[model samples]
Target: MNKAKILVVEDDRAIRNLITTTLETQDYQYHTAAKGSEALLEAVSFQPDVMLLDLGLPDMDGVSIIEKVRSWSALPIIVVSARSEDRDKIDALDAGADDYLTKPFSVDELLARLRVALRRARQDAGPAGSPEAVFTNGELTIDYAAGCTYLAGSEIHLTPIEYKLLCLLAKNVGKVLTHNYILRQVWGSALPGDTPSLRVFMATLRKKIEPVPAQPKYIQTHVGVGYRMLRIPEGGPAAPLGE
Candidate 1:
């Protein structure tokens, strides 16, 4: 596989150096920008495979950069910021960031997240730029064309809403989907007091697909932000029929 190109957009000299050095250690091709304007220019000109963005840029807010880049490109954008609050993460994600890494993140974790984004990017750019007709992660399988889902090769029945939710997460696997984003996609809009209902539905959906709902291996809850569908490795035990 070709090493993914990365664009590092951080105004802090120290943090930029640190990230660039780490990328170098991994032999990754990278470019840097200290301001949002420069970041947008590089994003269009260089066309990096993935971007590491800092929410606080000298020229403009990082979320603005995300929205602009998203207008034309679907390349993975991972927000790396000091804004660890759930609201900040949600804002960046809603703006189209593929992932969010808090400022005090570990090098290992950052690299791991980058790899995941790259993998998703490659999968998205399927053979000759076509979207995959089916989605699979671990024991869960989604046949988009047939509108069916399976766990351990057993067809699992899902309500219309549950199926929609599962498909949404599967399509954006590895990327965080904020509550609002999910609501809009799954139910048409995020109505007031609907988040709580969404959570309840999610619980029932998990019970059907998770081997152990208490320790989910597929769908992950992000507290205030939203949910993410994890890409689990193949060969795991199948979802238990009964506890």
Candidate 2:
């Protein structure tokens, strides 16, 4: 089996060395870059299976790198940064990061997240010779086989987590998926305290898929329970949960 390739983009030499050492110990084929511009070039040349990115690059912001890469590829990106602020994490995630880890993160946890990301990527790729599965409702469409989402004839960009959340709801349209259920299915685990993270991802997903996020016509909140993706009737108006 071919070892997975990883690209580590961190300006700090110490941190970069530590990450590369860990990757080497794990038997991963890896490359490193110390600047955003170099990272972009390496990403194209290396074509890594996954990436470890730092937000504080000298040439450009890591979020910008994420946005630029996401413009064409679905490569998994795990952000490793010292910025522990929620806004920073949200920004990176919204910009296309698959996961975020603050400075002084445990190597074990990082490896676990990397495994999860790789597994999700493989699942999303589906199996060879299998028929494509495409789900649609009015103007919203999800092409599971192609790993793409479209809203009103235009392709929509969704973060890894957002796309997973949307797929879960879209697959089970009209079913009220509890927070715990959605969290476990999309995130691989569910803790009572992780509800807020699930809510945040759901909000982001709605904003990308809903015509009016404030008055969401497709995804509806059940209030205190969970959310439901409304099943649009053919040539008819969307109905509420109980209707």
Candidate 3:
């Protein structure tokens, strides 16, 4: 097909139909699979440009499907599911899904995100990054191109969202990214305005990346504004994050 082929792997008939109708209206070539096995076949045969995956499947766990598919492809996998728990969302993303959208999403917002994700995937996998992909703060390094991050020489494990949030703040640097801004950019469009959950996640992240969990060094709190990534000044050696 001339249009970009999109795959929707959702078991719910209503949700599948909704997504298909939306894709058809947009003039996109699409395929649908109601089970994980069928979705695997679709992946091999249909060669979809993007995939919308639902976590709950009768035969296989969503995480397994993601792990299996990621073995070969870096396709932009945007998860579509009713599961709202933090661990559920984090598991999908950490398993290699590129984005997540909870249930009852607006069609317009989904389409906008679809366009953006496709464009970004292409740019990221392009010949050379527009601005390069490494962020360095003296001894600390985050090489996004390599899918690896390090402090001094050893690597650290960060949940997918953690890494994504870090990359966002690192890219912006001195800019104070507001709480809502952080939520929308990293979480999704549907996140509620009152974000105690976001604060919880941020606290967990700070514990992972702060020089002192009690007193953060690299990620600074801007009071009620938000957080900014700060560089330790020359001749001043800040303790390592997670120390």
Candidate 4:
């Protein structure tokens, strides 16, 4: 495989130099940008495999950059920021950042997160003739690794959480996954108890797979209980865009 390309976007001269030297010493190809606009330009031209983005930029908010870039691309974005608020992390994730690291972080931690984010990004940009981790019913194909449904051979867009939930449901097939089970497994122990999020995610999944989202056919919600997938076919829907 070719060497991975990394973009380090930071306003601090000292930190930028430190990162540049570290990457160079390790023999990784890298680019540097102190502002969002320049970073964006370099992003498109440089074609980085992963981006280390600082939330506070001289030209624009880091969240804004993520939103704009995600409009056209799915490049892995890791937010390197001094902002430590949970809400800030959530905002970044919601804005399409794949991961977040607060400032004063260790280089080792950064490197570790880098591996994870890049792995996920590469998986998202799956290769041609990728193994079908799916079974179809009528018009839907479920990708196991990617966790998204395909309609008529076209890819369907889905939130990260929604994707996970989908994989859980699809993998089980006829097995019923209870509400608490889905919540605990997908949301983590940090978030305990009821999961309104699961409900919302189910609705989104139904919209993408069901011919009529209002009354889902694939994902059936068992009242006061959970959800189930009847029989997974070889693949999902066959649309223009592939999943």
lDDT of 3 by residue, 2-85 (tens): 378899999999989999999999999999999999999999999998898999988898889999999998887878888877
**Candidate 1 lDDT, tens digit per residue, 1-243?**
347799999999999999999999999999999999999999989889999999898789999999999899898999999998988988999999988988787888898788889888988888988778888888888999999999989999999999999999998888889999999998889998999999999999999999899988888888898998887756753222110
Q: Judged by TM-score relative to the true structure, which candidate is superior, 1 or 4?
A: 1
**Model 2 off-target regions past 4 Å?**
129-243
Point to the candidate with the largest lDDT. 1
Find the 10 residues in a row with the least total lDDT in model 4: 234-243
lDDT for each residue of candidate 4 in 131-183, tens digit (9 for 90 to 100): 34765556667767655678878988888887787777655544345666677
The lDDT values for all models are 0.88, 0.80, 0.75, 0.73
Candidate 1, pairs of clashing residues: none
Judged by whole-model lDDT over C-alpha atoms, candidate 3 comes out at 0.75
Ranking by lDDT: 1, 2, 3, 4
**TM-score, prediction 3:** 0.56
| Decoy 1 TM-score against native | 0.94
Question: Which runs in model 1 stand beyond 4 Å of their true positions?
Answer: 235-243
Model 4: residue 10 alpha-carbon error in angstroms: 0.4
Residue pairs with backbone overlap in model 2: none
Query: Which candidate achieves the best TM-score against the true structure?
Result: 1
